[model samples]
Target: MIYLQLFLSYLQIGAFSFGGGYAAMPLIQAQVVEKYHWLSMTEFSDLVTIAEMTPGPIAINSATFVGTQVAGLSGALIATLGCILPSCIIVTLLAKIYIQYRNVKIMQDILGTLRPVVVSMIAVAGLGILSSVFFLSGKFAPALSNFNIRGIIFFAGALLCLRKTKLSPILIMVGCGILELLYQTIF
Candidate 1:
């Protein structure tokens, strides 16, 4: 029963996590903390930290971690499968039909149109947490006091690494983490 619940919960999370990562975080927090009482806000914060430090999508990481905590190995497997199922189905269908029509002008036009919209969504997700992380005075936009230099370094370095070099993301992350330690300790 617990494993079933975990499966369903993660299935919902996977199905609706449109923009990915931070976008899905608040929904997971509400589901786990408010609706189910599975974890406290602090625990969710810890989970967010751990997920951000890892390699995969935040929603999948959260599902796996929370599921395992709730019901051990079976929970982990079920939740992971549930989280992946929606994407699997969607991709399978799209591949089957989209491949045949992918070069069509209408389909090409639609996908081209979606590119900028997706970029805008990502920007919105990035800015959403700024208020929560930096500003405590109730202002909801970026200010000088709460600007995250570490985050800027991480983003810029990661972008350059991926675009200009052949370094893997894990190696880049590790290097950035070390730089962060040095920046804190020395500067």
Candidate 2:
């Protein structure tokens, strides 16, 4: 039953997660956090952190972590396969279908409509990721904002480091950890 759930959960995520792996973030968060309650918000944030730093797609890493958390190693293996099964079927089906319908007007129209939604989903995922990192610091409803400027700087620094330098992402993560400790020490 758990294995079936693992398969179905990821199959849904995989089926609906458009715009590639990065765009899958919001879907994962929604299903895992909101729908299933399988992961807490903090855990989700940490999952994103580890996923970004680790060597796989966010969805796959999330499946592994959440699955493990839910049911240990066996769960992890099951969930990972669940997450990937749709892709295996999808690529195969698309490859076979595209040859016959590559220039079809309906296909073109469908893809056109999908492109914007996919793009928005990607942006929404980015915002969700940023919010998880910053929590409710930027919420505007009651106008409560308690952003840690130092941490924001560190986040920006990570981007700059990646763009301007060749420092590995792992090193940047370690550097950020060090910076967090130092920020606490100094402040």
Top candidate on TM-score is 2
Candidate 2 lDDT tens digits, 8-126? 88888888887787789888888888888988876777888888888878888888988899889999998899888888999899989888899999988988899999899889887
Model 2 CA lDDT for position 8: 80
The RMSD of every model to the true structure, in order and in angstroms, is 5.1, 2.7
lDDT (Cα, 0-100) at 177 in candidate 1: 71
- Residue pairs in clash, model 2: none
Question: Which number leads on lDDT?
Answer: 2
**lDDT per residue as tens, model 1, 1-187:** 8888888888887877666776677668767877888887557656776888877888888888888888888888898888889878877888998989988899989878866765675565455444333444423445676555556556777789999999987788688778879989998
TM-score of every prediction relative to native: 0.61, 0.82
- Candidate 1: Cα lDDT at 83: 84
